[model samples]
Target: MKPLDTAILLAGVPLASPVTLLSGCVGFCEDLARMEGFDFSAVGAIFLKGTTLQARQGNRPPRVVETQGGMLNAIGLQNPGARHVVDHILPTIQHLPTRFFANIAGSTVAEYGEVARIFDDSPVDGIEINISCPNVKEGGAAFGSDPKVAAHVVETVKRVTSKPVITKLSPNVTDITRVAQAVIDAGTDAISAINTLMGMAIDLEKRRPVLGNGQGGLSGPAIKPVALLQVWRIHQIAGPRGIPIVGQGGITTARDAMEFMVAGATAIGLGTALFRNPLGAREVLDGMVAWGQRLGVANFHEIRGTLNQP
Candidate 1:
């Protein structure tokens, strides 16, 4: 099947395919774009690395440690800040074939608003509020873990930008639906579920935590089950409200993307898999086409939320 034949829309943004490059993995899209056979048009969207109001040095050494099925990372939202990205990066990449989404994070609600406002005036196709970041004013508690805080961030950013606001929800919560509902009520245009779960590894030889930061977000195949469940749950709540879901976590192949779509994800995000293969997106799109052909699925949307239960 043709790539366009498998196209799906997310929050009014037309994706050539349901596959998208997750934030923090593509390095502003330049990394994969440089790959020999990488095709940006094969994927639906590209989420740039998380950007804060100001530049962050990120955590110390040993920020990433590989695990059995995934890796642990506490990169600390390292970036060149919103202003620099707006001035330098976006201009160079604004002409890419696919939609570009800015992933913005901040320590305070006002800062999140400021970043969103900056990107709003830029050429980005949308804004994804990274509410999973620790709220400094709230004693390092993640904004995504609390419905109120998450809602406030969404409300603040929505007030400043006309672009679609996609709230990236954290998996480290009791009832993911509560947070999803809160953000939707606060005017978020869409939801991206299951940001890496917080976790850590240990160095048996050194007798210390593996990551420089005591804890890091766990991502890759390990979190696929958890992410699938979260996407399904969020869809149960937001899907009825006309809000789309970006299902991501441990997605490495076409089968993985199909599982997410079948569970209710309108779009799938590929992150950790990129580390293993820069051209993973193209392969995923191919797999989806093959799968669609086998199942006689004409449109990719047909498989969404089609989970069978007795």
Candidate 2:
């Protein structure tokens, strides 16, 4: 049998590996790249911290709280603004071995467009529309919570950048497929299923929320089931359309990554797993190759969307 081929084309961009270091966890991929055992070429791509039109101070103190099987974070989309990232930061790491994507977020539809427009002129390989951010113009309700608002955000960003647009959906909605269908109609090149679920942690002594922002996004092993279902459902909508899906949420092992691939994720996201093991990407890649060899599968495509449903 032939050796397993992990390489793939994600929304027209060539990816040497299916493992994509997710946004916010890898942080520009600088420090991690400089680590002793880190291999930039081992992963397909890395998404930078969420960037907005302007710099943000982020949320209050105690932004993260650890839970039983996961963690809650309310970082509040803190970043150095879009222009600064495109002008200063992109120049530094654009030459890295792996592709880089700008995860853009904003409080309004226009802000997302402006930010995407900025990155559009840069060397970033692609753009990820982070609709999980609150729409300040609409009384701070999350943009991903409403199908129409999410579609509007995607449409606005799609108009500004020619790069592949991957819309990240939030799991806090009643029906995630509605938002997926809306963005698909709005012309997104790909989809990132199941952004962190909304959750809160309470302080026993203080008698208040553990996170400073009152509520935070939950991620880790606890959310794997939710993430899988979201990816499967989104794939049902995107599969026939030829739109790729980047599956994420609480993947820590190679088996976990394989599960995502079989569920219809063309590319697997490594997020919270990085916090526990910075070198998890390489480990997962090796394990995937071994699993493929054992199963006599030569590539990820064979494993993708092969779930046997009753």
Candidate 3:
């Protein structure tokens, strides 16, 4: 099938493909561009690293640890801040082939609004409100765990930005659908489900946690099942409302992406897979095309929510 035939729209932005680079992975799309044979146009959209109100030093050493079938990270949303991103990063990446999106995070509702406003005036095609960074102490997952707070964040950011606002939900919540509904009601253009689940590793030798922060967010294939369930649950609520879901976590191959699509994810995000292969998105897209051809599927939309229920 043609590339355009596989295209999907997210929050009114037409992506060349349904594959999106997850936030905090691509680092503003520069690092991936430097890799040999990496192509920006291969995917639908690129979500830059998590950007906060001010520059942060991030957590101490041992922020990332490899786990069975997945990895854990507590990067602490380290970023160059919103203003620096608007002034330096966005301009440099304006010519990329795909749509550009900003991943905004803040410690307070006002901070979220301010960051959203900064990116709204910039050249990004959309804004993803990252209310689910598990490593932080105050803002990230703390607000996401509560439906009211998540709704308030969505509402606050929506009021300040004209750009599409996609809310990233935490998997740690008891009832993800409640949070999803709250954000959708608050004017979120789309929903990105199943951010890294909170977890930790221990150093047997040192008798301490592997991560300096004592805990970190677990990601990679290990969370694929959980991600799928969350996506499906949220889709049951948001799909009828015309709000798309960005299903992510543990997606490394075409089969993984298809599983998410079948589970109701309108878009698939590439995160931990990038660490294994910088050109992972291209491979996943190519694999998806091959799978589409084999399955006689004309477009990705046909595979979305095709899961069989008993």
Candidate 4:
């Protein structure tokens, strides 16, 4: 297992801890950065919500549905738009201590590149191409499920900017590693495995889908076991190629972070847990650091995949 450390380095940025915040709104991201003074420093980085060139209203009401494994969301990448993010959000963190990560989504290659260009000059540390979102019209799954389309999105965004690109992949596919390899081939700097599992719930009384969209991405503790499996599997794939892995999915405690590190994750992201408790990120980081110290683990990287060595 990897040893614990008080700080994690991401794309060369010194994050006080390996716990990163996953969000979708500019205002929330800025506020999170501002909260660092109160020990928000453990935050490895922040992943902005899905973005587009034009503002979107997202899906209709009842977009969130609960399932046996996790909750599904049909947020649809609602945001104030790319230009607004640059104008309004970039300034809020001009002097913040951590790295800024942007999550982007698009219906076409041009839209993806355009949004990538918008963040090209900002203080953001990296970009996460959201290839896992289900396509609204295309019969195929999200771009990430289709290697050809996934590679194209990675290559398209790579053409516009030099910032480290993190391609977020979905677990709904048959072969996640294959999808991951395709994006890596196109030049993404890192990979975030297992976005949210696909799931749905129904309203018994209404005899309709619980969520307005019928299906939503499932997340939380229910999926942690699967998330760990995916992270461990992807770590194996990335090892031979020297690519770093950002572990995410159902992380709610420090032990959870340790599990991923032992399985082979460079850093980690805290998702749905953030909504249940804003302080959840800080708490988990603190616990992980303590556990590492207790185990005499000095650096998390050391624990990365230590359990799998021959």
Candidate 5:
């Protein structure tokens, strides 16, 4: 067992692993199921691709481009909609070794609650409200950037489902910690800190934007500084209260993982790097294990909140 493998208690449910693979684009139908059988042993669980009420084809070509330290993607939020995911993806993953956390998106508050209620009856372990998807026109950025709307969405979904709810917040706000606290007050089981930061790239040669959407969510190592700031802030304010913080955004190595832990993140999520190398997720996990051994820590939990000062 890895050092981070101490049993995790979430709303009275015990989880075997603390590492979760973050994804927003699992293929259609049995594709997710096949991926699960082959990769489930590598991590604690997988957050399947975000699904919408209606299927989306996402953005146009050149939607993705490589940047200085990290890559930028404008893949949009393309998925086969909720009905197809339910009939096709859920069945295959329901029996995997790791639990399934479904990320649902929409253009309105009602849509968030509507889709969450469906997962309540599925074999899902939890629902992660992805309110920070920049490619979408309706729900994502609108809900996440506004503290009142962010809290409202969580409260509304909580009323409809018993599943442990995780609200993924946006980093584009003026005050990230304030937004994090908004959802906490709304009663979320966990707060997934530091979603991709909003950024743009221009093609000087053509006098146009790089992505079809004109702008895209900035992910990877470039945003690590901003992401670290947000995660640390949440740690300072929320850690003592027992709320679990799931850190993401620009984590590429075991040391990066350690920073999140020291910043008081309970768990870490891997996103953009997975596209560059399929082994990205496994490498991070293995690195953390190796780091723990060198540090002479028996259980990784002891490293939590190492930076907080009373």
Candidate 6:
């Protein structure tokens, strides 16, 4: 049997594998590097935590809560600002084997552009615009929820940066495809589908909200079905244009990752799953290789977006 090739050019960026460590799950790649038995060369890319133009204190405590099949997080895109990241933090992780992409967010369109500009001069291989952070009270899901506004944000970033830009879409929207098309038309190189779903939990005893923020983004196995559909929907728009989709949202196992690929994800993102299993990336890659060998396929691209209708 031929060896399975688990590599591809995501948005024209060469990657070692299709398993990309999602933003927020891996804090600036430093934490993951310190973990035992974790191989940097085994993964494709790492999207650093969401960074803004100015430092943010984030929301109050009680930010994360465990639920039935997943967890709710209102971390509010906490980070030490873009300048600090580009100057101090990025230098420390430059020796990591894999590619690093900056996950950028802001309270306004201009702020998004400024942050992108800051990262454009850094060592980051790419930039992912976080227009869909539901935990934040301003500029996160707000910019992503509107097609025109989302396009504006993408265009703004594109104007300032020479690096490839990937627009992360929000699942909270009524029609995600509309936003996907809008960003693609605005010169986005790739798409990251289904950021997170808006959800809330109440302190039944106290009669107040469980998280510090009234609402938070729900992730884990609970949102897999929704994430799959959204990825497929966005793929219909991105696939034809030759734009890659970074499918993420409840991918915890190899099967889940394969399902996302069948649904049209060019590369799979492992987010919430990392919280429970830090070494899940290796397991997922191993499983994918085994499945590929069993199917007699030399590469995963052969099976990507091959789902059939009933």
Task: Please give, for residues 1-310, the per-residue lDDT of candidate 2 as tens digits.
Answer: 6699889888899999999999989887769666765687678999899999999989997998889899999999889999999888888888778899999999888999999999999999999989998899999999999999999998899888899999999999999989999999999999988789999999889899988899999999999999999999988989999999999999999999999999999999999889999888889999998998999997888898999977
Deviation from native of the Cα of residue 271 in model 5, angstroms:
1.1
> 118-141 in candidate 1: lDDT tens per residue?
999999999998889999999999
Query: Can you write out model 5's per-residue Cα lDDT over 102-211, one digit (the tens) per residue?
Result: 88887788888888887777888888888774334443456888888888889988998999988888888888777788888998888887777767788999999898
The regions of model 5 sitting more than 4 angstroms off are: 1-6, 10-13, 25-39, 133-141, 308-310
TM-score of 1: 0.97
**Which candidate leads in TM-score?**
2
TM-score of each: 0.97, 0.98, 0.95, 0.92, 0.90, 0.97
Q: Name the regions of candidate 4 deviating beyond 4 angstroms.
A: 1-4, 25-27, 30-38, 134-140
**Candidate 3, 1-310: lDDT as tens digits:** 3432678888898888999989988888876665666677678898999999899889998899999999999999889999999999887878777888899988888889999999999999999988874324453458888898889999999999899989999998899999999999999999998899999899999999999999999999899989988998898988899999999999999989988998888899999998888778888988888888877887888888888986
In order of listing, the candidates' clash counts read 1, 0, 2, 8, 1, 0
Model 5: residue 218 alpha-carbon error in angstroms = 0.6
Residue-by-residue lDDT tens digits, candidate 4, 174-289: 88888888888998888886688878787889898888877778888899999998988887778677777888888888898889888878888888777677778778877877
State each model's CA lDDT, in order.
Answer: 0.91, 0.91, 0.88, 0.79, 0.76, 0.90
Lowest-scoring 10 consecutive residues by lDDT in candidate 5? 25-34
Candidate 5 or 1, higher TM-score: 1
Full candidate order by lDDT, most accurate first: 1, 2, 6, 3, 4, 5
Instruction: Give the backbone clash total of model 2.
Output: 0
How far off is residue 165 in model 6, in Å?
0.7
TM-score of model number 6? 0.97
Clashing pairs in 1: 220-250
